[model samples]
Target: MFTSRGPTLRELAVQALSSVERGYDLLAPKFDLTPFRTPDRILDETAEALRPLGPFRDGLDVCCGTGAGGRVLRALCRERAVGVDFSAGMLHEARRAHPGAVLVRADARALPFRPVFDLAVSFGAFGHFLPRERPGLFAQVHSALLPGGVFAFPVGAPPHFGTLPYWAMLGFDTVMRVRNRVWRPGFVMYYRTFPLVEVLAELRRTGFDVELTPLEGLGRRPDGTPRCAVVVARRRA
Candidate 1:
């Protein structure tokens, strides 16, 4: 699912063997060419979904790789937009792509910001965090926002059992687990780790009033459920 401009298999192998930060540093220049980057359609659909709930003044993008989420923030927020990521290389790319955005290098679990943001969004970065790390990650996002602020992210509906996509994801996660077990610096990306029910519970426990809205533009499943939904978590005012 990578383009001609994407990293080579050898390059990807080198990345997989390194730490997450180092891997992203190596992959940063070509990240957007890969399928791993958040697609424009998803970003547009997310902005559309968030439009009604906002008139948001300031926006923050948690784990904003190459500023895709920052672009969304710029669209939704009337005032300033900032992006925070742990990878310096990724932040360099983000700054190049989005010169107007204020980009900071910091870990998601210990975000270095006050409760000043009116809205926060993240894109395609959750897989890097383990299930146990999610609560702290959510708490960091919550603390980075104003009391009435919202944290938003898109989550895909799980694929049907035995389907190609399901098997692909399963195989990917399995390979990652095996790699982590064998390797020194484990790259912690697992596709199947973030279940919706568990995620909603964590958000609630972290003091967010959670809700989900179907992204209609992404289409539906055979059973008529949304293929993807945006999870909107609002900190209690």
Candidate 2:
């Protein structure tokens, strides 16, 4: 629906009606072409924002769809980068795009790693997790990292209420709620589920010391606050 190489409307419809994992599997081949993929600009700016915080040895990309976060990890990590996702097809595309990175098929809520990585990053996949599931998810990421390891991801400012973008997000989430009500094996994406205040508290509860840094290159909102910020949660040694 986004470009010539993107999925057709019919393909998107099929994906929307399927289970989340199954839907991503169906969309995997064209995922990078779709608007769902993280933009290159976001990745580049993220790398730029993270450069000062790192001298990272190894990195992990959580819910690493099509390897977007892997690219960020490659730029930051000194040794190697690895990506993990539950969708086999997404991992397949990730592997194809990033031949050097190790791609593992695993659910983010139950990451299969010891305290090995020095840094972990996720991009554009938080909506797949419900608010109720976030604590367990954060705990898993925490367990996967080494002492004092950093977990980072970008969060955008909420669109101003009554604005077109705000309404669009509200409508999309409403439709997803209704869809899930009657659907089997619900697809869990929702735009408004991850509120930053609650998220910071949850991360702290999960044993990470959290900090937020404005991504200045992405520009600022009209109120002079950042349009987007990166949440940097560090595991305590």
Candidate 3:
């Protein structure tokens, strides 16, 4: 459900056909209005969950689209906070909404800062990165943070195998696959790419001490597993 100012059906159609960068650019103006932006409830819960991990000084938000996670950084960090994203449009919206924070336009695979931040967080952006890209991405984030600094983000549990939500995600990925096969520029959002087991292994390979904390706000499955969890990885000293 989009807000009153969210993208129109026509705009959504246009974005669906465009590459990820170009689509976000086109949707940037109305992005906050869309359901695509990370929900405020998640932000609130994340900030509260991370409270004990602080008092953080410098913070960085990787692939911060329109500053949702960046706002979390602002609360957790006492000193400087910066948000990085490759989308000019998303960064533009982020700048307008978060004037006090510095926004850097760059690929997450190649961050510009070095041993500068104590805390780093990202949300809802890993879908854009292919699984092959995780090692490089995590390494970049690791290189940017000081020793013992954290890089955290939330990951949702896989949906029921045959449920509507599961099928919906499957269909979306199928359509995206077809679209990429037929299109020139590719859009890289997948419903299931970063599995928790593989992700933890990659983080370990990238020199992070990793742990998962259950996020109770999203509730649990019938099996009693957490519906979502925060992957908190600390850079090794």
RMSD of each: 0.8, 0.9, 1.2
**How close to the true structure is residue 9 of candidate 1, measured as C-alpha lDDT?**
99
lDDT of 1 by residue, 1-237 (tens): 988889999999999999999999999999999999998999999999999999999999999989988768888999989889999999999888877679889999999899999899999899999999999999999999999899999999999999999999999999999999998899998999999999999999999999999999999988999988999999998
Off by over 4 Å in 2: none
Instruction: Give the whole-model CA lDDT for all candidates, comma-separated.
Output: 0.93, 0.92, 0.90
How does model 2 score by TM-score? 0.98
Q: Which pairs, if any, clash in model 1?
A: none
Better of 2 and 3 by TM-score: 2
| Global local distance difference test of model 1 | 0.93
Please give me the total number of clashing residue pairs in predicted model 3.
0
For candidate 3, the TM-score is 0.96
Encode model 2's per-residue lDDT on 76-185: one tens digit a residue.
Answer: 99897998999999999988887777988999998999999989999999999998999999999999999999999998899999999999999999999999999888
Candidate rank order under lDDT: 1, 2, 3
lDDT per residue (tens digit) for residues 1-237 in model 3? 876677889999899888899999999999988888888888877887888998999999999989988778878999988999999999999989978768999999999988989999999999998999999999999999999999999888899899999999999989888999998688899988888899999999999999898889878889999988888999999
Candidate 3 error regions (>4 Å): none
Question: Cα miss at 98, model 1 (Å)?
Answer: 1.5
